[model samples]
Target: MTIHLAVDDSVAVLTLEHGRGNTLDTATCRELVLKLEEAADGAKAAVLTGSGDMFSAGVDLLSIDAGGAAYVREFLPALSDALLAVFGFPHPLVAAVNGHAIAGGMVLAAGCDHRVAAAGPGRVGVTELLVGVPFPLAATEILRCAYGTNPLAALMYSGATLTIDDALARGLVDEVAAPEEVLGRARELAARLGELPAEAFAHTKAQLRQPYHERIAENRASDDVHVDRMWRSAESLANVKSYVDRVLKR
Candidate 1:
């Protein structure tokens, strides 16, 4: 029930209400795809945010443990494809992060054209390396664009957690505002976008994203190799098991 679709005039808001952390998993991804399909047609702009204090815990670490690398290789991209649909949608997409965003959540937020966060929220960054799995090609491309030629490879490799202020400084978070103002700000920006000629904005956005999407298509060829390595890596196995153990410990 976390992925609720709220529409008002030309704006559509998809919110994550899943538990405290708002961690997205396979089911959430599927639900999101369905919601987006149903809600996106008449909307001028879309805003994505999480309920409560956490944007998302990223990928479901527990799912990885339950099925091993096979789960990641086979299913994670399917979920991301849903997110990518939003990323590549003709209209503007805004990320209104109400709380923390990590790993896959970071990628989802980054996928948007503009990213805004709550000033008092926890943090946002990719921590995939800490868990021993490589980030997906789409995420890599998004981060590379956000971080530039000097991508935050080390952050991904080291699983560093960036604060809201630091995320802004690092160019990861576009703007930070009070928690209550997050959605309003996104809607405000969406209005700005709506005022512009829709065709022009859509064309410009598509032109900017084409190169990145093409690059991911190129990576698709080698993606299988990345998948195979995880399936065989002891580190990947150990990381998944550890994450699973966290749930058990609770």
Candidate 2:
């Protein structure tokens, strides 16, 4: 399974475990949505983390290169769906960013109600532009909701990863913890948040997120068509290949 779900008291801990980096491929994205639905049914709050030292390396670029345009047509929607599921979740969702959270991974963390990163070598940021792709509409809206337009624009434009200190300073992460304590800290936060009156908490969350949801609903169809086209274009595919060769070395 790409995601493993475990319940600790009223808190559901969802750990991403697809491949070494927990990259968000089509299958993983679909599974994330399903697991989150299940979490909503069974848990009061949730904590999302990744196995080992990588929260997620982001989208499965190698898979994209191999699958080509046909796969891009399929993957983009699934990726957006997964992001929306996390962003719109009724219960409080905490991100335990144990390691590198780049591109889509960073978006997932931003979708969470609160974020805590492991204090060490792991970096966090949005790198979609560096890979020569535009943000899917849902992703852009989610980042805008979390960081506001100006900071979101700066992060998207630069595609630069930041240290935990920088991430905390920039408000990307709410707290920092030792590598081994990241999960514990996240679970603690989740449990505390779970203690709130469920209906009230859920309602408040929905109210706060309603604006972004409306924006996503209004613009996603047309924006995604353009995003899909760009992702499938020959130029973007070439850029993906170059990124893999030079940065991923795979």
Predicted structure 2: clash tally: 0
Return the TM-score for each candidate structure: 0.91, 0.98
Name the top lDDT candidate.
2
lDDT of 2 at 205: 93
Model 1 lDDT tens row, 1-250? 6598988878888898765577767778778777777666868888888888778778777666777766766666666576677667778778898889988788788888788899974788787776667766776777776677555866776688889999998888899999999989998887677677889998998888888889877776587467657744778789778756865347
Stretches > 4 Å off in candidate 2: none
Q: Write the per-residue lDDT of candidate 2 for residues 19-57, one digit (tens) a residue.
A: 888999999999999999999999999999999999998
lDDT of 1: 0.77
**Residue 93 lDDT in candidate 1:** 77
- Scored by CA lDDT, what does every candidate get? 0.77, 0.94
TM-score computed on alpha carbons, candidate 1: 0.91
